[model samples]
Target: MDGQWVEVADRVLVRRHAELDLSAGLVVGDGGCLVVDTRGDERQGAELAAEVRRITRAPWTVVITHSHFDHSFGTRSFLECPVWAHEDCRADLAENGAAARDTWARWYRERGDDGIADDIAATEIVLPDRLVTGVAELSVGGRRVVLSHFGPGHSGNDLVVHVPDAGVVFAGDLVENGAPPDYEDAHPLGWPPALDGLLGLLGPGDGTVVPGHGDPVDRGFVVAQRAEIAAVAELCREVAAGRMGLEEAVQLSPYPRETTVTALGRPLDGPPPAPGGREIMRARSWGCPG
Candidate 1:
């Protein structure tokens, strides 16, 4: 199923792509549909839009998981519909969209992937019109879908799509399946709790969890990954407190050395800290464990 939609639930579908091991979602309801994460570029988005049309003639609303180029740049093809994302997503796209495009394009071109690089360079960035500050409920046709911001994990603004009846959560980049969790724009201290909040959304019967990239996963997988991330978070604290060296933290991390190094370098995601440095403020906001 390289470029086809695989149904994980009755009407909830995921289209897996070989480009970046990317998976885009489609939730079909009685009178309408929901599209999750438009592909990478206008051409790719158009292809996805056409595929969505094949499965759903019902009007579709798009929700981006984060502001990463691959997940958001294709948004132009699904224009005129209300697009939803976290508020920080809008700011990220507005401020760094061009830079991301340039950086990725250059990287791709350097690797001899000029075709994809050209597509990235030519794509226009589209910002979400509907922003979710914390949590927002949406009705797709008559089906109930909830969008929630669990706190910063993969990016400053990570939005998750929850289809309650289906027990499937579109967990942007918060939970990666095929590769190590990205830390380039991540908050190491906050990531584990973000996963905790995500895990909380899963009921006893709920199992399917869709990652930003790779195949769908289950609660067991999420639980294990959460533990791994939590280990990294603890290592970050250890390094910060002078209890452990940076290389030692990297050596102990569950993820790769490079990934751990990047995560270790990031500041906790939030406004500038108070005089005392309130690291727990974000944890409290997400209701994370002390």
Candidate 2:
């Protein structure tokens, strides 16, 4: 809730929101600056923009980490500027943004948080103007910010923003700290490989990894989380391959049973989730799957 900027590197700053403990990045290069993953709504985005102004007045380009409402909805406030995200991110927002907005709005209403619901409803959904599929390089001020989509994991649209100069990876929802991974729209079987790609990007040593929410973490943290995902992926693979039963797999899961059930329930590469995905997505709290 402080909305203060925590400088991780020379010019790379992170503003960790008190709400949801959401963290967004601001990289000040030489030419222009880069803002990673806008907040939840227009008000929040405006607040973020103002916070960035407190740091620098350089023109800013926005890179969305994924299409989740908390990360993409506030994007409209930064409109008229270049907004970047995975291609699937654009598609997801274009197709489901409104529905997600309505669902979250209704959810808040049910919880008697009419103020939050109203803010969500009032915020206009904005899709990415530019898209990143594999990897896209950009000059933020004078620094290089690499945006990458390492297949599908937390979400098909998850993008990892790597700041080599800063030795920090802005790992959106793909890597969550202080909470369990959200699998509402995750690719369970593919999540581990995606994390493997992240580890590869990290290379050697303990570089900083900023999760979507929570405090910044180190490589060891990611490694431990990676193993959890790997176990989940293997379990899902075994289940899908008919070598294991879902119930038995649940018993052996590394995560809590509910979280494990949710992870296993996610679609790997098949038709679609067996319903409840939307509701789970809508009901997600602090960007964490319930």
Candidate 3:
């Protein structure tokens, strides 16, 4: 919905879209704002910036959830403002940023949108000026915003922003909505604990949760997702131990079969008649057993 805003609370504004939504928070005390994540590219981010202008003129600070191209690559549009992200995010962008750009550009090109691919190729990578290890606090318009690094779950680096007073948390890709979780770069073993940390910080879903994608949900939603993740982790353990074939594990997955297989951090041993028929194994040992 272009030029539209959904107010999660008095302080939180969410711009919704079919693929993903971007969240921006306003802190009334210091007359400052914190943008959770930028959009996919310059044009998308510029559109988001225009939405921010409609709400408040407060100086803005950006908190990147992770370094994925869709979330962090668009930060170039907001570079004049202060940007904050996990330290590993900066390193990821430095090492693999160009490769990510090329990959996505090819993806868009295949869709026959060469212009979009070119736009993505032309955008510069933006790194965070400020980095946090465990936690960092800032006053935005006199309101306190807590930026905490949960752990190596979704990615080696993932950050979630908590506003205690307003009882809102901007949970990055740590949580997804409707779509299956993407764990190609995720620590499947460590992912459950990251959700645990989010639960602990947000107090059992009593507050509002602004996920990196999808509509805002309550703590119960997270709790349900956590159960699903636990099940996937269990399946991973089984596949690793040879207790279950990859096909069986995929069938038991709470998420889509393809996503479950990829998140196991391995590839199929052989080709299957169908996409999910072959047994799978982890490429590297993760030191866990069923």
Candidate 4:
């Protein structure tokens, strides 16, 4: 799918990029359109913009879900539109934008694709003009779209676009469809509540949910993921409580056990405990115990 648009509801379009199969949404209201998340780089973002133009000629407003390179770095290509994001996302991009560029550059070089990496390096990070704290509502084409910050889940700063009228939520990196959830920069303990907030906004298992990395799913999928997350949280708690060693916890976890264990700041079995001892303990105490 070079780029396929699925009509999510009456006027919402969920666009899935064929390159990485990354998903984004376009909401058409009476006045204009609201874009959920941009693509990875300039070329990709331009392609998505073209798709939007093909569907509707209305002016667009962009909301970035997080500050990851794949989602926010492409905003520069959509510079003409007003961009919105969490305040921490802006700070992250400002502080580590160059480092991200360098990391991607090295990655592409290792794959013998210097041009792709160079293009990523050339991509400028665009910060959001409208920064949000907890929740903010905006009128896009006359329809009310709610942007809520569900604490820290996938990352310290993550946003989910909830269209109550449409009953569709554009979840950035909070939920994944295939492989396993990415916990590299994730708040393992806080992730469950973030998902809970997403489920809460949905109100019921009736609307379409467009995830950052897979095909759109229903409320049932979200609920199932919640259970998986809960299990991981329990394993983290076990490690923190010394009831289970890191390796033992990883052995017990149901989802990306190894990755989730390490991301929770736990030791990789026999090694000395992590330095940020109190933080992990707090996370375990606050996380789902069952």
**Candidate 1 vs candidate 2: which has greater TM-score?**
2
Output candidate 4 Cα RMSD: 7.1
TM-score of each: 0.91, 0.93, 0.87, 0.88
Task: Write down the lDDT that model 3 would get.
Answer: 0.72
Residue range 1-290, candidate 4, lDDT tens digits: 23678898989988876544578889998769998888767777787888888889888999999987777777877778889999988887787767776766565567676666677778877878999999999999999999999888777788999988989999887887754676656667788989999999988466888888778889999889878877787777777777877777777677655456556573323122222121221112223121
Off by over 4 Å in 1: 269-290
Backbone collisions counted per model: 0, 8, 6, 3
Write down the lDDT that model 1 would get. Answer: 0.83
What tens digits encode model 1's per-residue C-alpha lDDT throughout 1-290? 57898999989999998777789999999989999999878888998999999998999899999988778989999988999999999988897788777876776677677888899899999999999999999999889999999888877789989999889999988988877887667788888888888998997655799998778999999999999988988887887788999988877888877678767776754332222122222212223222
> Which is superior by lDDT, 1 or 3?
1
Greater-lDDT candidate between 1 and 2: 1
Off by over 4 Å in 4: 266-290
RMSD values for the candidates in order, in angstroms, are: 7.5, 2.5, 7.5, 7.1
Candidate 4, residue 188: how far the Cα is off, in Å: 0.9
lDDT of each: 0.83, 0.82, 0.72, 0.76
**Model 4 Cα displacement at 169 (Å)?**
0.4
**TM-score, cand. 2:** 0.93
TM-score ranking, best first = 2, 1, 4, 3
Error of 3 at 95 (Å): 0.7
Candidate 2 residue 238 C-alpha distance from true site, Å? 2.0
